[model samples]
Target: MTDKAKKKREPIFSPEDRSNLRWLWLGYLKKRAPWLGAVLLMILIQGLVYQQFLSMTESGLRVIFESGEVGQLVLVCLGVFFLFAVRGLMSYLVPLVTVRLSNEAIFEMRRDLIGHLMSLDLAYFERTKSGEIIHRLVTQTQQLGVFFGLATAGAVRDAVTVVIVSGYLIWKNPILFTTAIVVLPFIIWVMNFVSDRVKQAQGQAERALADYMNGIEETVNGMRTVKIASQEQVEAGRLMKGTGAIRDLMKRVQTTQALVMPSIDLSSAFVYVLVIGGGGYMVLSPDFDVDGAGIITFLLGMVMVFDPARLLAQYFGALQSNLVLLDRVRSLYDEQPSINDAPDAVEDFDTGGDIVLDDVTFSYSEDQPLFEGLDMTFRGGQVSAIVGATGSGKTTILSLLSRLYDVKGGQITIGGQPIETLKVGSLRGAFSVVAQDIVIFNNSIWENIRYVNPEATEEDVWRAAEDAEIADLIRRRGDAPVGPKGAQLSGGQKQRIAIARAFLRDAPILLLDEATSALDQATEERIKAALGRLTKGKTTIVVAHRLSSVADADRIFVLEAGQLVEQGRHDELLETAGLYSQLYQAQKKGYDGR
Candidate 1:
């Protein structure tokens, strides 16, 4: 194929293909032990019924030769009828039970996958796209249903049937039965070959699909902005490119999977033709005197065995893909959380909200440092400010206190103990943070406020909302929907709801990253007053490029190029006439029209 043609083809195998389908099968079966027993009972009943049919055939022949009464023949026919009826009823019941069981298992598995994703540390989310994580949690797990139900477990039942039928065929005609059995291993080898390719292609396709889905999510989420900015065509072009790649990958995967079935069918047909032609010639000529009727029954048994074996064979490819899916799942399952509770981590920690960072250095990447040699502290029950230009590590300092990332060097202690040694939950429980870009869910205003503390009563929620000055806004909603991210509300209103949530959390430590940056001057003044009162008994750390916002802080630290260059009370820093002084003077000059 040409490069263009090859590119158009979908991938066949995925990393999940290498996953152990046997485990997926065994685990699911173990979960559905009751249903499996029912299916087994049905199988046993059917086998006995089939055996009775054979017996009836022989008995009827003898009766005809002996000229038995017509009543006896009628009785024999009724027995056969009853057996078939019972078998059909059991067959129906088995599937109904197994299907229900499998569906419930899938639901449980999906729920666990979602919980697993949520348990992952924030760093994993930072490195992974929202869509990719969602795809694994939703789409990939959805694909496992067929594998869990009809493919894996169903494969087991059909395998048992094939063995029983093969045994019958061998007893009736050893020569033909041996030949069919001998051909199975070769057919399985070929199926396994195709299965390997399917797994590899599917993995690539899954990744491509994740990329496409991510693009789609971004576009949908930003559709309004894209339209207003006249970037629709640009976005559409990018989506088209992504969609095209996904299409190509899927095509290759489907083509490889499709070929396996037909190839196996052709192999089976060739074997059948050879068996019939060779068997006839041998029986007609010399030593072999195989009875024609017995041969017919044996052939019928072979047909029954072949269908299930063929089904099992075709499943090799699906099993491969399912394996890959599970591996991806297990990868997530096996991950160690970046942040976890320490053995002796603090509980109900009462530190007067003092935070101390001593010679801390940190980096997201090995070679690129976000901050270096940062020493800072916020006094208990005091408002401290960090001011810096963009990328000056202001936010990085807040993150350090939150313990979002551990320092690469030096120690950060809370209440005279290394932060790492303290229980992570206990340490984090002490801080309430509101970032520059606030997020609100599509929920009732009351629910959003209470999100910080689910156990918080309605009275507590209302009190927080009132303090944050959003009580009236929420009351006006009167149980109406608040659109996603609070799009239905004004920017200032949305910020207040976020504040309400943080207020309700009632942590001893507060980190506000430009919390009031979006509000008008009048609203900013009101919120500032409220926040000032709120932080009176808490350690408050504020980051603001707006010098006026930080002027009232007990102490202000100026950061530049990942280093703290200046620190002192606001007026004292101004007297020093350094970086902080320069910023204050510039803002003052801008205000005075000098």
Candidate 2:
């Protein structure tokens, strides 16, 4: 190996990765040390028993072939048979314990990974692709699980067997022992060569697979749009391209792995030839001081060492390939949630009074600030609305109020308390949000409704459903699958389901974000009625692009390019003939034209 390659083998992790390894060792491996130790002990016993069995064979062969006798043949046969049984048991237990230990650790790691992902702020997920996250969550861990099996089975058991057999070879005949292992250096070099390519190829293959999965998720979720636009062929071509990329990358990975066996075989064949030729020459020469049985035993020991040594080589190569997966997983684990409770954050803080954005400055991107020194408020115990053009920062205002994303500057106060000072859960628990993009899980309506409030009784769910005018949906669908994102339901139906969830939440504050924007006039009328009841006697804040929806709002705040350009009751703003009036008039003209 080159010096660079040798150096590359020393550090599995960079300096940044050292912190993450502490978690793997301290959290997972250390916890499994007892079981791990027991497995190693079992492997050790099995290796010693195997060596003893080989010695017994040498004795039996000497009596039959050279001495022309059959002393203790029956005893010898029974003893060898008993050793085989013990060896068989060890084989079963070794893999069983090793796999179980790995499986449990992986199960816990998965649980922790999920919990950590949930704790991250919305911005992290917004910037990240769902496909990449899923790949790391599911696929990376699975690869590690398989690698652990090889690390234990090949590294430990095979290693112990090789050591014991090699020692016996050295004691019985040093010349034969040295000749038997002449191929070791070549095998090591071959594995190192394959390993360098394996890491690079596997990394690319993993990325390609993630992209392919992401494409599947996107196209499958947007299937309706594909069909509506008559772009099925285009989507097919896109996916075909993705699959082709994955296929080529995998071919590289598989091709590299495939070379391992043949390379080892060639070196092994050389060892077999040298050992056989050398053993025969020794048997004929009295100067060597060895019997026919000794020569036979040396040849058999050579046979025994090759398989384990071959496995060890393959294990190292596979370990290199899987290191990327391990790094990907560690990268995720190392991510700290950008939004978390402060050191002195208060959880028991009360919620009431106006929610004021005190000169708040924020942005989704650094170059273009969405809300700069912007200020607004929704009165306590009253329904309010914010209206604007598409890029007017309407939805962003709602996100800030709910603390889904923190403001870059200034402070937001609820009930006269700075929101950042309160625990995130306590702050968010004060409001129930129904967003433009509603999420419906792939489960029955009953579970979907009840999940938000696990303690809420069945009757409570049905009542909330009735209040949202969706009781009939639950009654009819009852336990039937909703499919992903509620594909089985229409837009109006999904809107109603979100409203039902809000009603069940019954938080002190209500946030209605374009709830009725996507519905038809008839459905809008129904949803408006539901919203009317939901907002009663609560601190409600509504954001919408449709001026008609917010026309009757108790107070209207009009935004223009992330600035508060207008605010008042609807008729009051219209009479002023400002930006709000222009928006309302334009919308009115469009509706009239339609």
Candidate 3:
């Protein structure tokens, strides 16, 4: 995020994000608590045993150096081996269980986030970038895994280890223990400084990474246009710039995290000097309780306590560094789609009815309203065409008819009932859309057609294909892959598949937005013929640019800047010499093959 974006963006718990952050994070963590508990317990037991092993070393040193008890030394050394074995096994089990817990959290977190993303309305997608969404869903959600395995769980268990070992050291020699822990406050201060820097750097790095991903996506999606324009070098440079930015930010994160270990080691070194210098002086003064053997034990115990303290410091740093992930993931999960089903919205509705836009008003921007007091009706069981120049709200009408963007004012209805009152599913289910810009999934022909209606039979698919004039192509291709966005097929062939989907859907209303545009005359006529059979007896709305295509419509509605300027059959519209006549005459030369 830019510095301005970071500033404008308050904390993750903004009013728009209603859920409590702690509760949201704990909700996923609670489900995997058993695995968490199992790992923590294993580490706790191992860590305690490690303390015993250090005590055994102290006893063995006393036996050899002071008392000279050879038999006692043998027994003490054997005890150390078994204790170390338990410690090693525990070290192995901790990671194994932690991984399982992390993955379990990752799976559930991703599942819930994806379902939420899908439930968002079209406007959310329009406003949010695809790469940013992918970052939230894929990259940020994975933070749950690391949050448990390496950060929170490790810090908690290691803190426990530090406490147990520190108590043992203080019990043995309070003077030396006090001297050994004098640097602890400094360690803590260093940790806090490092954690804040790491968190800031990592957050910036992740934002940069999202932009890098979006750059690659744009370059790939528009490769054909890039090649045509000879902008390959430009796109490559842009992508490299994104990658370079991400690299620099990530390096900043690593540099901050690197401060943790070295600061810990330096603090440990200070404690070591204090313990060694103070213990030797106390022994010489004849005021200490024990001899050199006891002093050796004090050093060994300090080793036990300080090492875990070091580990705790590292885990604490990691925990702080990734705290921002909770905000990132929660930001997405809290986005509530405004356009969900109303409390009284009805479904199981009748399919056959006139689509009426009554006193409708809408706009993509408030200052530039597209439609106001717009009123039109397409009678059931008839074909209606909408024609307008570019920017004259041709596609906007189709979007309004389908309720893709709800009108700012007034009501759109089917069978005299407002569409907002009907369930969104039932309302959208009434219309089948085939726009000039069609979407073809990367799948086989059989799968592609069935995707529109999964319950469609193979026989039903074949019949629909034949109706849309795509049967011959499917029979030849034999369900070969369409590659990305149907790159394997021609424009006309892809349009035919979309037509097949509509045919298979066989809804009561049809929406064709420039469906017959950007095609050779031969291909246009063939698709027009298929469209002719497809629209029979249905309330079909067609938005066309070429006047020649809608000349045979039962009604042609001419719109200018979101207002209906004229409405009549083709001969009647041409005779009116209004916007319809002007647009028709502009394209008359090509219409007449001149």
The number of the candidate with the highest TM-score is 2
> Total clashes, candidate 2?
0
Q: What tens digits encode model 2's per-residue C-alpha lDDT throughout 1-594? A: 887657655343445446655767787889888988889898998888779888998988876877666656767788899998998998888888888888888998899899999998898898888999999999889878767764756588888999998898899999987887777778767777788788788889888888899999999999999999999999999999999998998898889888888988888888888877898888888788887888888878877888887788778777776777877887886677878889999987556588899999999989999888888888988889998888999899888887889899999998889988999898888989888898899998878777678899888998899888889888898899899998998888888888889999999899999887668898788767778889988998998888899888889999889999889999999999999899889989999999
What tens-digit string does per-residue lDDT give for candidate 1 at 185-242? 7776677667767777777878888888899999988987998999999999999999
lDDT of 3 by residue, 1-594 (tens): 787657532332344233434555577777666766787788778768867876887788878888898898889978998888888888777877777777877788788888898888788889888998898788777775777665666677677778777777777888788777778788867876777677678778878888888889889999999999999999989999998898898888778878888988888888888878888787787666667777877777777677778787777666654566766877785688877678899996656777788899999989999999999998888899999888989898888777778889988888888888888888888889888888888988777887889998889999989887789888888868999998888888888788889999999899988886757788777767778889998888999988888888899999988889999999998888888988888899666787
The residue pairs in collision within model 3 are none
User: What TM-score, over all chains together, does every model reach?
Assistant: 0.88, 0.95, 0.93
lDDT for each of the candidates?
0.77, 0.85, 0.81
- Against the true structure, candidate 1 has what lDDT? 0.77
Give candidate 3 regions above 4 Å deviation: 1-21, 67-71, 591-594
Q: Report lDDT (Cα) of residue 391, candidate 1.
A: 91
The predicted structure with the larger lDDT, 1 or 2, is: 2
Candidate 2 colliding pairs: none
